[model samples]
Target: MPAVTADTLTLPRLPDLPQTATAWRPVREVVRAREFLEGEGFRVRRPFPGVGLANADPFLLLDHMGAVEYGPGEAKGAPWHPHRGFETVTYMIDGALEHRDSAGGGGLITDGGTQWMTAGSGVLHSELPPQDVVARGGLFHGVQLWVNLPRAEKWTPPRYQDIAARDTTLLSSGDGGALVRLVAGDVAGFRGPGATRTPITYLHATLSPGARLDLPWPEDFTAMVYVLAGRGTVGPERRPLDEGHLAVLGRGGALTAHAATPWDVLVLGGLPLNEPVARYGPFVMNTRAEIIQAIEDHQAGRLGRTQVPHVTAADEELS
Candidate 1:
């Protein structure tokens, strides 16, 4: 279980949906996460950027870190690097990660906490396991998501949002069978603490066996759900889904899902930016020329300066 949890029976509840009142989003396709080695050679499960990302406009990538227990001196993390043209949201479900950036936005994000960094223009940053984690070793699990900014906001000023786990809005299902943690955006008139420039809904939900969740989602957003643990089904069609699987949903006014076992999942959706994307290394931009410009800017030290460990060609592909 994650460190942050609440008794559902004691929380406010979401309104129940009338059986015929709303259109439930249909499951369009499903994809499983593939193993990928990331920062400092730590393993991660990546579901997009290769699978069904065309529908993930405004969202660039999703990387799921482990729930693995680490032996002493076995934990690892991302070293110093740079990013631009988007935002990075890191959520710690079961451990800790420390962040520092040239933009002066960073802190230690612990269990159930989140770090939201807008790498507008550019910023040099580093993400590392706190010395204690590296020294004592413990269970570490988390997620990092790259959210693409609209072209208009790509050049906006850089910033950060440090949302503590307690700041997240907690709500229960109409029947009290499910617990929903709202990290960003709105739900049934309840708002999450993290303020985002683009319209989006980010949620982590836990359901008891046989429990169902019907969410009021924005009709204009592209939506999907990713299973973090256990077994479940998505959509009214009851498509089979489980750990490491991502189900893309077609447009609709709401989303419906059910848990076949104790289940944990991430439900997210965002307005599509619908713009051209040119990406290379750590930069994502509108055109190939812009990508080159970003590289040149970094070389010129316009993005910022920080001592970085040597990164090989393959490692640079982590963009």
Candidate 2:
């Protein structure tokens, strides 16, 4: 739905970095810290939490979930889980989450809410943790992204789109920055709402101190930038990312983001399933005999939801 217009920034050409010297190493820095997601008896934390896929062809995942501080009528969660062919995006900031799934779909996100699940072909979800947001302590934080489903829509079926917050579509600049284009397509000129089966693109920036932004990506798609708050400067080789960093950008142009004291980022990207993936566990098939027939259809249960648990080591594994 390309109607974006506000000082337009061009983009549309990527996939060529591969010849040597770390493939020209343009911008492949990933530095994360501040990782914490405790609840349900926090004592160094750990509860269905996850943070895997720091890098994978085209971009596979990136989960840095929770910011913690729950309490009253608690709801720490992560129950029924299962996915196929990929596509899950949840972005909140400052408490609240209660998504349900199995197709009927459920909801309850807060602070700039944006859920966007697309477990193409299969889906059985749960991400509860909201009872007035840990009983009023406030600040739970969020960020969950996993995209890669293009083998002709990888199975094709399960879908969702919760995007709230006045239907997301804001853009501002000059000091106290602002940007929220919650899904594939449009920015600067503002034109984002929800519609991402895989031509992905999502933003939710906020900068103040020193403000500066130019972000506009889609050069064949496969971008990245996840620094949720403070610390910036990212393109033109500005470098110096901070706040749970992850700035992997190689193609395209126009990405400046320079905040240093007041920042919040999320500029994602898409269009890179290039083919052959074959992941197991939660199924991301593309081969391997369709991930062994999706693990024999969830172990012959026919995967209808009701039982899909059994993943532990204290559970918090993500690759």
Candidate 3:
């Protein structure tokens, strides 16, 4: 399959239907993200295990860190870490995150940008605030998602997809009241820029007051929506959802949400990987044995060495 690139990709048409039936999936549960300090004292809210992992197969974890303004020298993002058997996606919403890894992969993901790093075999990396952000002080907000790789593809070569804010696919609702940004899936007629090993759909949407979106979704995929801001109603039942809450959707033909106020939400879903999962810290493998191997490899310096080079203005400006 071809990689989702800037020039090679085209917008797909929205699925046509005979009727506008709102077969929205009902919200199964509303859960809150567990707050914790991770990666050199950076605060984060995790919403997965707190809710339930079985409903979120292929997606192991989600860490939402800050929409808060940081004082000078206050930001302490993730330091050196190791990962394998899955992919880590960093989506920046407010500040800049400078990343450097053992596999010679490094970049600066600024506001509205993303860095999709596939830690297939193994890799050591760090995600931290840039010097400018730390020195000058600014708002810091972002989400880090762990995407599980099938057992057969766990050892694939690692790679990176750095997508700038401008390069992402942005689509508007029919009435132009709702804006949808496609990062890694098909939304309406638009497809995201990142290619994936597993079939998944990830969307970031913002709706004006009274705006609504009825999204066509695959029935077989497990879907959920996380509210980032404002208030909204979801599914055929129009279950009310508030900020900082995650709503798991049941099986349905489509996923829908209507904004009661200006609302911001993230939609994520993927085909389930019905396999045993053994996870330890950053490593996720099929069995405890594989997890042990990953740890041993890192301790023995097999993952690779960390390389931190200064990010130039030109490098940070890449789209």
TM-scores, one per candidate: 0.93, 0.34, 0.89
Residue-level lDDT tens digits of model 3 in 196-283: 7888999888778897777888888889999877899988788999887899999887887889998988899999999999999899
Error of 1 at 187 (Å): 1.2
Q: 1-319, model 2: which lDDT tens digit per residue?
A: 1112122122221222222322222465555544454334332221111353434454565666546555566546676777888777776766677878764566877776777777777767788776555566555777676778778988776756666665665665433244434444664444567676567667776666786766555567766777765787776657888777777777654455567677777777667766878787577878998888877887775654532232211121131
Give one digit per residue, the lDDT tens place, for model 1 in 64-169. 9997899999999988887889889898999899998875557898988888887878888899999989999999999898888888988877777777888788
Residue 176, model 2: Cα distance from true site in angstroms: 29
Worst 10 residues of 2 by lDDT: 1-10
Candidate 2: stretches off by over 4 Å:
1-85, 89-120, 124-126, 132-134, 150-153, 156-221, 239-248, 252-259, 262-271, 274-310, 313-319
Candidate 1 segments whose C-alpha is farther than 4 A from its true place: 51-55, 305-319
Better of 1 and 2 by lDDT: 1
| lDDT: worst 10-residue window of model 1 | 307-316
Sorting all predicted structures by TM-score, with the top scorer first, yields 1, 3, 2
Output the number of the lDDT-best candidate.
1
In terms of lDDT, the poorest run of 10 residues in model 3 is 1-10
Kindly provide the TM-score of model 2 when superposed on the true structure, using C-alpha atoms. Answer: 0.34
